[model samples]
Target: METTILTKKDVEKILTMEDTIKAVEHAFEMHGKGLTQMPPKVYLNFDKGDLRAMPAYLEGKAGVKWVNSHPENPKIGLPTVMALLIYNDPETGFPLAVMDAMHITNMRTGAAGGIAAKYLARKNSKVFGFVGCGTQAYTQFMALSMIFKIEEVKAYDINEGNAKKFIEFCESKGVDAKIRGIEEVCDCDVLTTTTPSKKPVVKEEWVSNGMHINAIGADAPGKQELDEKILLRSKIIVDDLEQALHSGEINVAISKGILEESSIHATLGEIIVGKKPGRLSDDEITIFDSTGLAIQDISTASIVYKRAAESDMGIKIKFFDF
Candidate 1:
């Protein structure tokens, strides 16, 4: 059997924020209409990190992603998150492509953030704030820029160096960027949090009405970035209710008996499918709780595989003969 393998660089060359946003939006629509089959993410917790097994099947594609997030990886000169993906043939049950998934994960997650902002944020949003200026921050900003004519950006991170680097990246894209305190960043029209914090860093008082938030960082239980009060007052929209309640931004709040499952406004898919409305009023606070979905990975990987094949970028190897 022949299998194609694509590296991170190969994947990046074929993927862009513009195409990814549309793919993720379509994935959301398919998932919302019950046209896909995706199991809840299964986890394996360790002393310093955790691993996740995510699998899904769409109309003509199927795949599984094995990924891990190590918070202390930067100390060892490695990324905080890494992943590998296997794209298989649904009809024959054979592997078609095996590729690095780190880039795919970042891009899809960022696309999800962008899609959320499109449905939930006001059309005229300009000022943007980013908390936790890291790898995820770059993609999040890229996705937002695709949709809005952002004028200014305020960034904040515990590591001053990370904040500086994030600001520079933004400036490279012609965005007015600077480092600011958490309180100041929170005041922007659209705020995105991408840190792996264990406690709340954004205070309730800092959140103003008519603001939209992308709670992108907290994907595991006990990890939270926003104050419970913020969730209480905001119209929370999650990618998947089961996953978000167990691992996304609202997990911590729900565990403390503060926010209820019923309080969640709707899934992003629901809004995409027209089952629920999005951004009803300019003054209503809207929050997108993203936990990253298996359908997202599979959908994005399909696009990457197709593009790589068209460009003849990946290496094809014979792994088996029958």
Candidate 2:
């Protein structure tokens, strides 16, 4: 049997944000209907960072992603997060392809945030806020722009250079953007937080009514970006209940007894599949706690694999004689 080797370039050529959002939405629908299998992420802790093993089966597609998160990597000329995925045939457990998952991760994570906003944010939301102006923030902007008619973007970062660079990127995209204080950023119609802060960086008082927040940074235990009080007042939805409770934005709050599992409104999937409601009123505050999902990677990978196979884009090598 031959296994296709797909490089980052190969995958990038085939994947698009539009297609990614569709694929991820389907994955969530399947998940809400109890049609997919995704095991809780297994983590290998390290002094500098951590690695995660994510495995999932959606419909007839299956895959495992080996990913790492090292916040200090950039100082050493590496990305804060990098990943690779092995796609397999569930029927025979055959390794069908191996591909880079960095873009897949970023796109799908952004797609999730967009999908969350679709159901949770007010339909007239036009002002977007970003608390972390890094690579992830770019994708988040891409996804949100596709969904809303964005009028302005408010960006904030501890590093002024990063925020300025992000503003330039936004301006090139023809969107009005400016660097703003964290409090000012939080005043937008929709707020996206991507900081890797261990403690709260966005306070409760800064967040206003009818705002939808995509809490993207806290994917590990003890890592939190928003104040616990914000969670207490918002209608909280998570990507995965178990994973969110363990390592998402609400983890610290839950551990500290400031929040309860029973307080969770619903999973994003539940809202997508109509099992629950999203943003009941214009005055309601909502938050989506995203920890990143394995099904998202697999689903996006499936699209990349299929498109690459049709175009004969990746290298194929026979690993075993059938």
What TM-score, computed on C-alpha atoms, does each candidate reach? 0.97, 0.97
lDDT of 2 by residue, 1-322 (tens): 8999999888888998999999999999998998999998888999999999999999999999999989799999998889999999999999999999998999999999999999899999999999999878988998999999999999999999999999999899999999999999998999999988999999989999999999999988999999999999999999999999999999999999999999999999899999998888999999999999999999999998998989998999898988
lDDT of 1 by residue, 22-80 (tens): 77898999988989899888789999898988999988999999999787998999887
- What is candidate 2's CA lDDT for residue 44? 97
Each model's lDDT: 0.93, 0.94
Candidate 2 residue 319 C-alpha distance from true site, Å: 1.4
Model 2 regions more than 4 Å off = none
